[model samples]
Target: FTTEDGAVNAGGSLVLFDTATAQQLYLKPGVFQNATVSAEAGVSDRKLLDEITPLLPKDATAQTGKALADRQAKDIESGLTSLNTMLLAFAGIALFVGVFLIANTFTMLIAQRTRELALMRAIGATRRQVKRSVLLEAGVVGTLASVIGFLLGLGLATGLRSAMGLMGGKIPAGPLIVSPTAVGSAFAVGILITVLAAWLPARRAAKIAPVAAMSSVHATASVKSLVVRNSIGGVITLLGSAGIVGGAASGGTSGRQLIAAGAFFALIGVIILIPLLSRPVIALVRPALKKVFGVSGKLASQNAVRNPRRTGATASALAIGLTLVTGISVLGVTLGQAIDKMTTDNIKADYMVSMASGDSLDESALRALSKADGVTALSPQQAAWFEVDGEYHSASAVTPGDVEQVFSLTVESGSLASLKDGQVAVGSKTAKENGWKTGDTLPVKFDDEKKGELKVGAVYKENEFLSPFVIPKELADEHSASTRPEIREIWIKADGGASKANEQAVVDALGDNPAMSVMDRQDIRDMFGGFINTALNIMYGLLAMALLIAVLGVVNTLAMSVFERQQEIGMLRAIGLDRGRVKRMVRLEAVVISVFGAVIGVGLGVFLGWAIGRTLSADIPGYALVIPWDRLGVFLLLAALVGVLASLWPARSAAKLNMLTAIKTE
Candidate 1:
């Protein structure tokens, strides 16, 4: 049975065709809707389908109803799943950071107010009441920040969608409404993070006696507590990592392998060991920085190592977000570079003109197109995709002697002079990776039945975008019985700038061919990989926010530090603690936090970036880790600036404290 809808591609009936006879038989004016669209006939002949066929395009109502049902269900399900995954990762980062900030801030607040809390206890206030008061304060602050952050996230997601839209990717359909469920979830998360952040300090507050608390003794040995705490956490972390790696190597569950064994283990290890790690890591640098980096440098190093928890908390914010964002960005950048190179390879034409519906373009259309002004060269490609062994793949047959002319290639081993060798040519990359050698028998299964056992003539380095190469035109025709291409894409090279004049001429000649999509080489980047750009832009924005949050963490940590040291700051101010020195100290603290974060963040990014490269072979494979040396420098500079900026307000706040008042408070 056969069918053709010349004009009203709108709807059509089922039909059959005979290959050898070049005959089409119309059984009836009928339409059939099946589970899959039939691109070509297979084993079953027309006689079988025609015998049982009905004369209808299925039920118009049922056809559309099924389509709508499937589409909506898929979209809704996929959209929710995507949203959940994205949100979970981001939330983990945000919450981990929030935990640090809340803990550090509460610790600082309690320390500064140690004498006050002790005095309160000395009076009539119970230890429970003192702890409760502190908790109440934290709750208020956390609630406010979370509400603000959620609202900000709503706006951020919209901006993200718009950026993606510009890159031509379909985001979740409909307005990205803030789901009430999401809002409630965020609120609960915020409160929980706040309460937990204050938990330890509240306990400390409960334990302090009036006089001892007033003396700053609860926080006096905090430095020692930090060592012990980080030590225990570090042991657990290393043990957990060993377990994960050992289990994963033995083919344990993939879920646990990727997450628990790999990502989670690394993340937990970093967070837990961050403080101890920062000490030795920063220790080696203090001497070098002290002599040359000036006073600010020395102060920065001192403050960074002074309070382990605060430093860890501040750095953790940047580390958490940067790890994930950098991981993804590395993947995107790798893919981008790979795809661009691929595009440059596979498309060997100044311009590609293809039917939107992928209709066949015969020699006649090719000739017609060539007759237009300045049409110097043309290449035609035929593409068909199929699946083998459950793996989907594509094969393209092309006759571009000018493929070298259009998309230039370097012959690594075999000569282009040996083009008609009836051997299959594979990319140098593809050949080397697959252990393919010249003169080796390469078996390729085209579709289901057609098999080609071609000798690997020569490995050619494909610098442009391409798939596996094919035999020359005549050999291909004989092998496939001269089966005409159902679809053709034309590449045109003209005399002038992308052949603007000739492009217009060709468009006019093919004006009636409504099913065609034409593109010049210039449009390749935007049209071919627009979605990728959108994803990058979204990530860049998210990273920017994370950086901002990191700065906020720095500010929060520095501010609390300054507040805790009000008396010390006041003492300095009274006895030559230059307001400049005070600012320097605060700024130094900020710098310390930023530098700490940057080292760990950059290290994590590079290490994981390398790990991620193992998943791909197109570009720099086998742990293709790049330091992004430039970005690292920029991050370092930005961290310094963030330190100074974060310290400014807090430094002034500390400098402004009255010596008498500061001393009396504790």
Candidate 2:
């Protein structure tokens, strides 16, 4: 008994003793503490609860095991839900970018095999047979890739679980289960996406005429097709622009939805019009490229615009990732600014006293805090969930007179001091919603069925610091829940305002409880701001996957472009273009395309951010549109860096091409 030890690591200190010894020391006759119960094997939770419900005393409460577990794991469940949602969204974006890579790869592959396809047609192969051949190849590649990807994903999951455990996360000890549904979904999505991406390219391959086998010309999009595509894109873009403008002008939840829809359409339109946009966008940057890189830069610009479709597809992936990141950044900045302004303008208290664990303070802690020296006034607030006319709402109880000293309440009608026993003060928004005014009576009930009618004595302007319904502390105590109500917060007005001495005095008063904390105005602001920053960091981590996929898309496009232009690069090399200049040309082309996409993405993101902020401003007080220009600039710079890194291998390969072999390639 002198020393204590645990048989297992249960994430906390534990002590074990014989039943009789424990009873003698901690349990007395006719008294009992909480007990844990487990159902017999094969027994359902419902049956267990049903059997145990009648065994408890009339005044005692009983909770099912499932309910208890759910209550304990609520926060963890919420966090996981949010994490899963973000991961799924970004994963979808990655897959969408992959579509462009797969399609582009198939396009180039078919172009390289144009003669082969035409020869098959000349040998009496039907168009359907040729198309099927291409599709069958895609299916085989998809199957192999899917298997490898699934195995890698499984390994990653196991590694992550071990890492989390090493970092002190409480993970259950068991083998990881690979569900059939997940396996099925992985293969289904992979195969479907690959086949779909290759369908268009396969169609193009099938259309190659028999005569094409004797010609060196490759298939290209006709001018008529470009005109049709551009027209469709322009119309969609116009409609999307109109939606965005209307959404910004009309501020509400509906407006937010409209903005979301507008963004979707705008993204689709922009993607379609990128081929047309490539000309002007590259043209604008061509002069700067020439000024800096000289002849190499000029050649790079020409190379980029040579096949606008390829350039457009390569850039689209990066653009999509940047667009999402920029929009989220804008929203996060706006929200952080709004919170800062709201806290500074509304909170009048000199210091806030609360628990470090974020739990409610007991009555003893509140009494001790009230005895702190240099305290001019103290307002202790208690919160509880109460039913009003069958709907559950949160209610706060506080001393009416003490509230005015610690909070800035703009009285729309009546006064806070008039809120006596059997009376309550309601926020303006709540009052308007329920059609309740000063002197109106509201019927409220507690969980124990304790009911009473409270008269509304005051109507105050709504602020973030105050709850909707404020009742007297005496009235709350009379409702018969517990002997003493738990205190949620205590606002203090120090004798000489907020200072180190005042803060130390408050800390000293609560010395018996080491979990209590006293925070000044700045601390409060920082605490809330920290929450927003944490959220933004998580979002950035999730979006990194999409950005990685975009980088891969750039690499794939540049490599394929090098393969298609092998002879062209050889011709340039023969004309006295050195290896360094060849490399510079490729790098400059990537830079132009990357910068082009980043510009469009950033501009679109800013507009979307502004529209969404306008919608939120109607509901949130002090909300304003805040554009993080510095962050946007950094994103553009990173995009340019991505271009340089992506082009390294392709440029090297282009530079290393043999002059004689490349010239005689055709």
Candidate 3:
């Protein structure tokens, strides 16, 4: 008998039982099945874990906490660490970009306040006092901004908590954590950045001579500075180039890390070289601008190169962000293309049935699927590892009929029909490496003391799916020690073959077999391809944050430029240059700098991407260099848009400047 109300019927269930005689099917004293004892109410969790530790195997790893609680904490901490690392890296990048802005702002502000600083020095203020004053102001501003930013970060974390759940993280909800370390670190970083960025400007301000206070002049980068900068940059570039070459020659994880390090070093060198190259690049582009946009473009071009150091700094900020964005895009596109090409070129089977890893396909299930409607041919294969001359190699055993029906084998000199008991087919590449030809006997040994000399039946071309050596199933079964030969994959060919139709028929025939999945060529590609794209998407999202910071750098530079050139802008306005022309000039200057950065970024990104792709292709077989030209075009267009948006406020501020006041001011 059951309760009148069921779970879905909007009421709770109730069970009736006799007070004295009703019995449960089973009873347990603890929540877990394997626990020897439960902790009393007064006992601490750590004490219970310590007691249980001695009862567990000596080699077993354990931690102190409730099982669920420990697991939940581990999962959440792991996820948070991964997420926090990525965010902090991006934050570091933003802060790095902000250095240029902060330095430039302070430089411009000090230049404008030269007279005021000189007047202070002339009166009673010491050089150290002036420097201290500036640092104190920066500290005040930094502290306030850091506190506000920290509070905002709390709200951001709340949103990210939800995002973590969507990304398959199992995060347990509890009281929001606000660590002292995090808060202190945030404040320390802000203060450090502000102080460091303001240092040079403050030093320059302190050196202002009281007599020269009336004069306004700015010092250019010294010849010695240029020489030292170029020499260091060149050495770094050479070292990075060497690393790339080394990475290409090497293989595996070490090679990948080398490549990343090389790319980073190369980018740093390029950033250092930007100031040296900016003027020459501007000279090269000036002729084209003069011929195309005429006077306005010429004027805009002149403004960009007028302050080469500042222009280069602004461009470098954008370049750093774009380099990473383009690099990741290049790598992702190449990987996806390689997978597509591998699928299309190598796989010839119409349909494939595969079991879960470590699971064997049932013989009865295979027989039933073989007799399924429209299945004209099926090739069941078993993968095996064999030792040849003390080196291990992977090979698969398949029937001869399976090759003709499901594979496009390129037989170099022998027939597939020659593959018989105690014989194998080797790939052409493998045969050449091993110095073996058709009809030659090669001693091979399998696990369980199964040893035999197998003749090379045929040599086929190397393919992604085709192994180094493929032996006949009959030969494998005869010498194998196991009672049952486990089939891992079955290649299928339909009578009236269309991949979609064949796939549907196979899926239908498989019925409720949860262990196997029916897939076609495209499906196989999607399985691996999806992972690459998802990784690329996550990276792109992170880089977008960096790019956003770079955009802010552009805005900051242009705003400072407007402040420095108020008198010049007023003069132009007084002399009949309209508001629209002034705006156009500022906007054009931003676009030129942005384009310069984009061009350099794309060139570097493509070169690095190609180098890495070529290195990986040595192991991956058929990977080819693939450049996504269309995407680069879109990236360039977006950079231009970023320039326009970055200039909007700065241009408007310049255009709306009071002509009389600006021209009259010192």
Q: Report lDDT (Cα) of residue 243, candidate 3.
A: 82
Per-residue alpha-carbon lDDT of model 3 for 1-666, expressed as tens digits?
Answer: 644332313223344544322222112222221334567999987888888788776656556447856797688689789778877887887787777767767777777777788789889999999999888877887888788988898998898888877876644446688999998998999888988888888887887776686466454556897899988988887888778767866856787789879887987888888877788887788888778876667888999888777787788877877777787789889989888777777666778788755466756666777778888877777766677888888777777766667776778978788875556888888889889899898787875477867788888887667578787777766655554566777888788765666667788788856668877767878976889899888888877776787788788878988888889999999999889988988888888888888878887888788777767886675677888999889888888899899999999999999999999855
Off by over 4 Å in 3: 1-91, 124-128, 164-181, 203-214, 217-219, 227-231, 249-258, 291-294, 354-365, 380-400, 407-462, 466-489, 512-517
- Candidates 2 and 3, the one with greater lDDT: 2
Error of 3 at 70 (Å): 5.8
Which candidate number maximizes lDDT? 2
User: Which window of ten consecutive residues has the lowest lDDT sum in model 3?
Assistant: 24-33
Steric clash pairs (candidate 2): none
What local distance difference test score does each model get?
0.67, 0.83, 0.77
Off by over 4 Å in 2: 1-83, 166-168, 241-255, 384-393, 420-423, 439-455
Which is the leading candidate under TM-score?
A: 2
Sort the predicted structures by lDDT, highest score first: 2, 3, 1
Tens digits of lDDT, candidate 1, 1-666 = 343333223232333454423322212224222433232355343543453345435553223435556887788788789767876766576667667777877887887778788889998899789989999988998899889989898888889778767866554456576778988988988887898899888888778878766665445545677678777777766765565445434432442345344666667778878878888988888887678756656876887888776688788887876776666666666666666656765555668887666456755666677677777676566554433334444545555364455656667776554555666566787677778777788565654357656676667775444455644544544544234553367777777747657678878767656667778886875665677678877777656656777778888887777766666666666776666766766777677778778777766666555454544443332223344566667766777787788888887887677777886654
After superposition, the stretches of candidate 1 with alpha carbons farther than 4 Å from their true spots are 1-76, 115-141, 144-180, 207-211, 221-224, 236-260, 280-300, 328-335, 338-351, 354-365, 372-377, 385-393, 400-488, 492-534, 618-624, 658-665
**Candidate 1 vs. true structure, TM-score:** 0.71
Clash tally, candidates in order: 16, 0, 0
RMSD of 2: 4.7
What is candidate 3's CA lDDT for residue 469? 79
